[model samples]
Target: MLEPQDHRLRQREYLLQISRAITAQLDLASLLNLVITYAVEMLAGTSGLIAIYDEEGDDLLRIRASSQLPRDIWPAFAPLLALPLADLPRQGVAVLRDVATDTGLNLRQMIALPLALRQSAVGVIYVFRAALNVDFSANDRQLLQDFANQAAIAVSNARLYQGVLREKQRLDAMIEQSADGALIIDSRWRITTFNKMMEQLTGWTRDEAIGRPCAEVLGIHSDQGVNICLTDCPLQRRPPAENPVAEGRITSRDGREIYI
Candidate 1:
């Protein structure tokens, strides 16, 4: 048996390793799998489950991962997810003793720790041990709580990142299909987004325009060939607007003068 200090040391190392693994994965499904697998491995639990709460008005808890549970008994555990989060302990865990005796499942004991952030619980992590007589010490609770905290942050970040990616995809689709010319620039005035319409208008393909300065690519000039884009750059003169409008004559890729 490891000494108390040694156990803590080992647990800390495990936490660091698992934290890296969790944060390294951005996909929600893959992150959940990593959570369950690391939970079972690090805690020496026989099986594990992670339930993520849906925040978009569903008030629903979805099971993100379940490992080594028999098909027939998984149904029994599913109902626990429907329980009022109000009933569960907020800062600690609720332990189930000898659940195998009650349900004839393979699990001997189980610990349910809420994945909490601030005062609210974002999700729950449950781990099962097959041992018949198990005693979870205060240190054990502390260790599980640590993992739960890190898991909550990783899950929440992944969900947020995924939502942003989906929204970006949706907007990109719209921008690509837009009728008028559309282009986007970074804070440094370098072209970051170039749509097909803008590509045609400027006669510069997206590959050629991205990362190039807007001044160089747009090459906007007055009718008398005086540089217009440099003097009236909207980003510098005006606050960012949703529907920004700029007008000038630009030299096309073919050296033709086009007025916008």
Candidate 2:
């Protein structure tokens, strides 16, 4: 058995570790698992569950992650998990009153903490203790609250990252499927994106073209045999408000001169 002071010191160290874990994690699923695992470990609870707010869910709250929660008793816990936000305790901790006596499971004690941000509830974390005699202490509640606050911020950030990633995927798909011979460049005028149409038109594989200078890939030159890309590059002269068109000729990979 550890002294109270030593136990507290260990708890603080564990909390610090969790702080680092949540900050570095961006994947929503992995973050939720981390939250529930840490919550259960910190509280010495038998199981844990994290439910995120979902408007389309039949219960309004969807169980996104669980730790040590038994599959057999999941159906029995539905009513408790589905409790409305208005009915849940807004501050501190409380008993899971929704757990019915007939549920046939030993889990009786619970600490429910709403994952709140800016006074709005984003989700909730539930830690369950199987032993009815062992009650959560005031310190336990406060420690959980502190951990929950960090977890809430992490969850919000992870959601934003996932949303941005999905949007980027959609945009990437649109760019690849576009019919135009599209090529993207960075500030240094290096090729960053070369789509299929560009690959076909320039006779350069995407793998061979990307990261190369656009001027080198296209080899565009005027009819007078002057390299247009090296002198008065059309890309640099394009007006911001109106699109500019400059015709030039390029020598393809097969040594054929193609007009653009």
Candidate 3:
């Protein structure tokens, strides 16, 4: 009974809900739940699911909360659902009008949208209604399609954030395990970070070393007794491509010799 323009406005409002959901939470599971809940409510779907494919695309994991189907049914559909349907005749987004008439098994009045990133199909978003009284309209399909696109972006961002966090943890562990004193410097020759060994060797804590200029802190001297911090400082000058390692002798505050 809704007019075309009214449906369009509803869809816009639904998209705004999805956008706010993605931005509100950094946690992947919570964000995904919000998306699925919003999709089901806005599209008048009795049941819905959000599945993410494994890296090999051979397995699908149902991650979001669903309404129509019991949680027990998902594991059985994992294998078939995970396979990429990109080559199907309908492609990118596929819609089934009738649950009873549709040939696909275990799905009824379903809308499947491929989740793509960097031109590669990563997974699919599925929304459906199981009741015989419920029917999907063109407007519903369009709204679900837009919601799927937003879901794809949210999933990609969450994955990237998790990846960065994992890398940071790995780097921190490696730095902690290193035997030699190691320090990281930016292009400006300022100390960005260093390992615990560096702190112990120089009698300086990490808080004191961070953001300080390397030349002023390390006090490097040449063989000729010239202060390397004043001129020809390896830390201050850019390194040659062929010989990138910069080696110099530094005198610590207590007159200890340190090699950088």
lDDT of 3 by residue, 1-260 (tens): 55768867867776787688777755766666666777877776766778876755556555455546566666644543644565433532233332223433335555667766778655677776666556777767777777778878888888788889899788878987899887788888898877888887777788899899877777677666676776766444565455444466877667788776
lDDT of 1: 0.74
Query: Per-residue lDDT for 181-249 in model 2, tens only?
Result: 888889899998889988878889999998999999987899998888888686688564266556799
- Candidate 3 residues lying further than 4 Å off, grouped into runs, are 1-6, 13-25, 64-108, 168-174, 186-192, 207-255
Give all candidates' CA lDDT scores.
Answer: 0.74, 0.76, 0.68
The global Cα lDDT (0 to 1) of model 3 is 0.68
Give residue 135's lDDT in candidate 1 (0 to 100). Answer: 57
Which regions of candidate 1 are displaced past 4 Å?
Answer: 22-25, 67-76, 84-105, 229-247
lDDT accuracy of residue 76 in candidate 3: 49
Best by TM-score: 1
- Residue-level lDDT of model 1, residues 109-219, one tens digit each, is 666788988778888888878776775556566677887887788877877778898998888889999998888788898988889988888889999999999999997
Q: What is the TM-score of each predicted model, taking all chains together? A: 0.78, 0.75, 0.67
Over 4 Å off, model 2: 1-8, 55-59, 85-104, 186-192, 211-216, 219-248
**Candidate 2 global TM-score:** 0.75
